[model samples]
Target: MQSLGPLRPRSTVLVKRPWLTKPFNWRALSSIPPSDYSNQSRGGLPRFFSETLPSSKGGVIRVQGDEFWHMTKVLRLKTDDRVELFNGKGGLVEGFIQNIDRSSIDFVALEDPKLVLPQTPQWHIFAAFGSLKGGRADWLVEKCTELGASSVTPLLTQRSSTISDNRVERLQRVILAAAKQCQRLHEMKLNHPMKIDNLIPLVAKSKQSFIAIAEGTPLVSALTSTTKESSGLIIVGPEGDFTEKEVDLITEAGATAVGLGPHRLRVETATIAILATLTLWSGSQQISNC
Candidate 1:
């Protein structure tokens, strides 16, 4: 038998590198676009979402799936294209595309992200989903994301229809797209559906809780009377509205009944009304403080 010397590992050769040749440049990454979106952010640069992101610079961030498709195929982004990335948790960063493949985009973040502090008294909505038909729920989710609500949860009630996990997932997709469109540093949340019984306990423990009903305190007035620093929970039912027993459970848990107006509103309309009112109210409150 022939004696062989200790085997050495084979060296691998590279033809083309997928990553950017030049080092990451914060300035280039952040270079401003034309004055089209003068009010805020880079106009030329598009935004994408990665569920979580690196806190500081030089970390490789990979974006995949739907976000990746939008970046490459849909948006036709090329290597070295500047773009903004945000995590749903109040994190926003500017970076340039360093590499791209069939399924993912790799980029490096080299600067501290601009952090957006949550609005004072962040508001959340717990709405009944069973009766929302013909894409009403999707519209609600999209609009809520744009309007800057903290989170939205579907509620189970006697008169409401049952929502599937698949439907909730669909709403989540809407949230992402809308967040990107509105340039939110923090994406609006879409929570798993909860039963009115389960919600009653949460409502009981909440400092500010309100319910929409036929006769009660005016919506705006109710919000105005609350302290500025209190986070709120707003509950709205489906088209059929909450059953007598469901209302009893919710209200007994310390939810203040609030009326929208003379006219009755659908689940989607009423929920939007509450959120829109809250948005305008929050802005005015900030101005007053300033």
Candidate 2:
């Protein structure tokens, strides 16, 4: 009742105090504009591989070795930055950098990771190509992953060139790099080199399979008309292509021989062409059904 400036009107006091009528806009208090972090909020950010990335959130993931050098030296990412992570086994997570060091990086998972389903139904490519001369094998692995091949088996056919053990290791590195670059959650499986005869049984088990041959039914026709199976395999032969006896063996194993084009393709070229053809055909079929 002590006259406070003649009771300066309760309504005026409420109007002057914004908190009385409106809630605080916390987002507007951010120092960095919303657009500054737009890329980090989306799924198309640069990805890194951590074989041990946890499916659930709250664990710290360590990035070491060449990946560390890449993030620190090349990309120059710093603390508190965000990155996309994959485990090369269908696990994908968005992580926030917690710490960095000379040899490694530690990031904390912010939320539950996502599992990316393969684009194609478990399609395997039993590529029996010869040991490519230069960097062709590396290129083949990279392109094959982008084209949606689930796995690639190197076949040591009768006509294949000599492949050193180091070559396979190098090719595995290429597969990993390619998978990360293409944002493929599942890394394409790279099998040890095996003889052509040893691969027939694997082909026989596929629900639908094809062998890329120079003179056979058109690939598109075969793929388009085939029953949609859960699993399939495509066999690609060496540089000189599979011999008559080898062809007979594969045919007997139930793989339909399909032709890619009129002209013969090199081992790498043919591998990509066959895989690309199948990927497109399968995608079209899915869209039509949708």
Candidate 3:
């Protein structure tokens, strides 16, 4: 009688034990301890830097660039030491020294690291600055990247002193170092050097653009409203400033020439002032959304 009828299929639902479900929820389902999730939930700064990288492919990385020299020679790090690492690609990891030799050292990746995204301002600043000599342009690029310039373009103007274009790699190194120091996950871009006449007409065609000229137009009057797609390009000139012909050309090309401040500034100083103003403007716009 028991074997006469066909057996019905059993349900595939298995009850999970309390302990099993609890650990799985805490570790697999959710990240970090529930009590400490306040900051993590709100997307605050990550606790660890480059030191907590996991052993997975691409999760953990090593920087053989000047960073290696800085780590070994400058910082005098040795085996068993720990450090945090970040690749400009938004990957952060914590790593420990596995071995230390004369030339290079191995850092063992430990835990799965959390990637921290940079809160880059909504707007982008393309600083087309006239060339400066004696590493002044290099300094300009470094500070600009630090202050949140999305990109930079070196301008070979009528008044420029330095025309040698051999410092691109050096400028990139400075940008990378600045990004790392500032905890900025976004990479700063450095475009090729171009003549002011050529770049202005090309850029002036954009929907959102402005040129910073310390005398022609008032700064406050230019930024009357901040729309979602608000952006501007600041043109900083050499010691003697942009040639009148160049200014005329840009003005004819539909670029809104704006001033920075009451006092005329050096090229480097002017670039920083413009960048600071733009950064503040971007912040004000972001807060206005609330």
Candidate 4:
């Protein structure tokens, strides 16, 4: 049997060559390596797939685009290579690299994954915050994923400086990578950017909503006083804060005004705090299910 030593972190390209190749009885393989898989630092989606080997098996999920590039180029993975696959389904699936070429690679799923979906009451953390300056919006999206935000909506407010350039493809990668690392099976819903005027109409459609004001009502008190039977929404303003008219419009639309803390936080900070609190609350309710 031939061996391929532990992967070099700095290796640039993995090419196919007889001398560089190793042999293994893929059919005899029993499990995935512990060193190659991790479920920490994952966020955004409850479930996602990285371009690497399958962690385990079941019905396969969709993973297209750049992920296909990683499989074909970076990994230098070839057909029949034994690999690992995970789906955040509470189990791992052992698979074989059945198809591999310059264009794509498909793993034949073999076993069940280990991570299962949460069965608790769903918490819909919807945010309507002003877009940030330069690349700050990207940073917000990445961190928000880790904080367990289910969806994020960029809001255009009077105080916001400029609208962000649409880079949907790049942003989606950040979310996908986070989800794979955390073993989350679901994806974060990212809504298109819209003005506060358009957002007001949707607020009335929700049964529960909260707007995080820097100084209005305390976060805990506001949340505890509300009914927990339905999913909720939270709106955060830009660094300069929401305009008086905007706040009143949202309030009249049924959004409860709430505060995050005493000190004022940046747009991203406030958004993450809201998501973290909601995620914790949702996770606690599902303790018995986990």
Candidate 5:
């Protein structure tokens, strides 16, 4: 391995944040990606997402297409601008604009890019927000990504409204933007829309699983015994909530039903609440996954 010099602090950390508006070329979102929809820029350096990075130290990594536009136009970066780059899979490197143009930017890796694998025991959230009114579903994904969830899968139950592929692609952009903002190493993954029946095997594969239900065990109390770092799954129902048979099916597949509170919560609200509570519980148990 080649020895590397210490990272240089950016002389000026641009205050301008990347424009993350959705539907900005939906095709670009489908083409590109982000962290749990989040990441925190280190050393005050601006961060951007790339699909791939160079294999060896001092390699050349190219930024083009929407990514190129974001850097050149949105961020208005110039040659020699010190910046950080990350691939969604935990690869990160500090490099400078070795060259630039209207079409693309080329970065010269200062040090070999390093890949940090995501920790074990990822917590995957399955939510039925297909029918959420307005942008609540989008908001739920944004916040969840910022919180560093392992993955979010749109759940389909008896009450779930049908979701289109285009919508999923739209959510992908939200995920990308959030991951970049939080400076998360591993991009929080966004799974495809899944039917309740399809989730049965996944539930069993998890070391632990929880389903949110109105008269069930308290959320915190439900996670009390199993916080030592192991993979798990959590499910949230759609508008009318899961039917008794549906809940029973998941429960029989080794999922425990946990209660949020007496008041009924919106689909998005319930999903975020459960995710946030789990994040806190994991922190207390020395297993903060976020």
Candidate 6:
């Protein structure tokens, strides 16, 4: 266990303004042309698709579904158009459109596939959050993927909102879109919804785990003091926060009860804050060691 010393209060004032009040750069906005595959930069901003195949020299792969539609009908790409392909299993290949048809497009690998290894120590944030309403869960998934959470699991807590199977599917799609935008070679794993009690034993065995609470140790202190080889889970409560019994169960199970700051953060805000803090803390620790 690590000591967080004393908790302190922090505050900031935010101002809101209308977008129309700001000066507009109409020319700068107008200068941007419509997106076309031909004008796509070479080795820069290449469109990404997920099609796993042999990475051997000159291997051919096929692109279909929404990806094929976007490349052909939407972007109007034709033969010889270059694109980047990843399998979300550490494979990244540079390929070019070899042929386009009514249903699919063929791609010819132009170079040997490159493997993007996971970060050192391979820290994984197993975010077990309650089901959020509307787009909140979707936003959380997208941001978590960008923040490099290895996996995210929706927790079924006593106070958690209802999460349908279809919602899980939608969240998975959000993860995929975010991964493509972030150019992540390895996709973030979105696990099925699980009971919070089921997560207790796993937390006890985790290399490191923290539960975000309002009146606990400061997260920064606990994280900075951790060993460089540490990697584990983070659990966040839902709207109205977790029940007292749930809190006791997690704390007793060996998870450190941590706090972001003085303010009570919304579920999505807290999720982002926790992930962002851990990411920065890990990166900074690595740099200092070097």
| Candidate 6: segments with Cα more than 4 A from true spot | 1-45, 120-130, 228-230, 284-290
Ranking by lDDT: 5, 1, 2, 6, 4, 3
Q: In model 1, where do residues sit more than 4 Å from their true spots?
A: 1-44, 221-230, 282-290
For model 6, what is the C-alpha lDDT against the true structure? 0.66
- Candidate lDDT values, in order: 0.70, 0.68, 0.55, 0.56, 0.71, 0.66
Per-model TM-score, in order, reads 0.79, 0.79, 0.69, 0.66, 0.81, 0.78
Provide the clashing-pair count of each candidate structure. Answer: 1, 0, 12, 34, 17, 0
lDDT: worst 10-residue window of model 1: 1-10
Q: On TM-score, who's better, 5 or 6?
A: 5
Positional deviation of 245 in candidate 1, in angstroms? 2.2
Model 4 bad stretches (over 4 Å): 1-65, 72-94, 111-131, 161-166, 283-290
Position 134, candidate 2: lDDT: 81
Model 2 C-alpha lDDT per residue in residues 61-83, reported as the tens digit of each score: 56787677777898898998888
lDDT of 3 by residue, 91-191 (tens): 55556767666655555556554444444453334344444657777788777766766667676777674434446666766776666655554456676
Give residue 173's error in model 4 in angstroms: 1.6
Model 5 earns a TM-score of 0.81
lDDT digits (tens) for residues 1-290 of candidate 6: 21112111111111122222434222222121212211322336465656453344466666777777778887788899888876665566678988887878777777666654453323344344545667888999888877767777776778885567667767777877787776555667776666777888887787777888899788878776776433677788877788899999988998888998899998889888877777676652221110
Worst lDDT run of 10 residues, candidate 2, spans 6-15
On residues 1-290, what C-alpha lDDT tens digit does candidate 1 reach at each position? 11112111121111123344555343333333223222454245798877555445665667777878898999899999988887665566778888998778887775656555554436788888656777888999888777667788887787776777677667777877787786766656676677887788788887778899887799878877876433678899877778888888889989989899999898888988987776676653321110
**Candidate order by decreasing TM-score:** 5, 2, 1, 6, 3, 4
Q: By lDDT, who's the top model here?
A: 5
Q: What is the lDDT of candidate 3?
A: 0.55
Better model by TM-score: candidate 3 vs candidate 5? 5
